[model samples]
Target: MALAVCVLFDARTERRIRELWARLESRGVHTLATHTHGRHHPHLSYAVLREWDLEAVHQAVDRLPDGGPFTLTCQGTLAFPRGRAALAPSLTAELARRQESVVAAVRATGADLHRNYAEGAWVPHVSLATRAPGALLPVVVAAVADVLPMPLVVNRAALVDSGTGETVVLPRIP
Candidate 1:
């Protein structure tokens, strides 16, 4: 199980993502919509912890200054190794700095950060398919292209349990 500091999408963006998930599912592709625990919310994670003291991680993140709402324009599709597919968001300096800050704060709590989430190494993405095979890249790409240049409004931040989808909603977008 992992815990992540995530920035959640606004209602319209969330609904659009969910609709995309349904479309992907109808095409025989697996998505977060029906992944593991089946309660995933549409989000982009700042830092994912492989190991952490829940309360400590939460407190560490909660202490960060509120970054407030921002927008991420997903302009392309990303097919990572191991059949993972996602939407590649056009990053801004503000997004990068916010992610770095969150990573640093979580690390300060002695949390074991997922290597992929390490500051400069991080690629901001909104996951679409969890196990799409290479043969299916075109399908994933086509579906994502339909939503290209999609602007995702990030209006909330929370500490989410990856396994169970349990969330500890933070007061501000941090």
Candidate 2:
């Protein structure tokens, strides 16, 4: 199972994202809302690990600063090379630094990090659809355009088991 470090949204933002997911699902677009585990939540991942020492990862991450809370502005739609479509966010300096810090802390644990999530390579996004067909791109974009520049507050972070939907580490970002 893959493990991920993610920044979770506040309740209002989470609700909005879930609502967007419902709209996309109605348009025949597959999304994390219907993920197999049935426990998917809207999140922006800082890193994903292919392999790891669980205890070591926990210890390392626990030592990093909470970085407090910050707001992310979703500006527009972004398409990944693998046919995934997401809401792209403005990567502010604070957000970039926080993410880079998380990457560093997680990497120090000897975990194999996903290259896409490495410090300089990470793309900040909240996924809207997976395997979205080329023809459906415009539809998806139109569905979410009115909500462009959505502001989401990152108030908490966690280490989750992607396969099982279990939170292994929940750091209180006070």
Which residue pairs show collisions in model 1?
Answer: none
lDDT of 2 by residue, 1-174 (tens): 798888888999999999999999998988899877868879999889999988888888888866778888998999887668999999888888888887888888889999999867899989888778899998789978979879988878888888989885476541
Clashing pairs in 2: none
Could you tell me every candidate's TM-score relative to the true structure?
Answer: 0.98, 0.95
lDDT of 1 at 126: 94
lDDT of 1 at 123: 93
Off by over 4 Å in 1: none
**Whole-model lDDT per candidate:** 0.93, 0.85
On lDDT, the leading prediction is 1
**Which candidate leads in TM-score?**
1
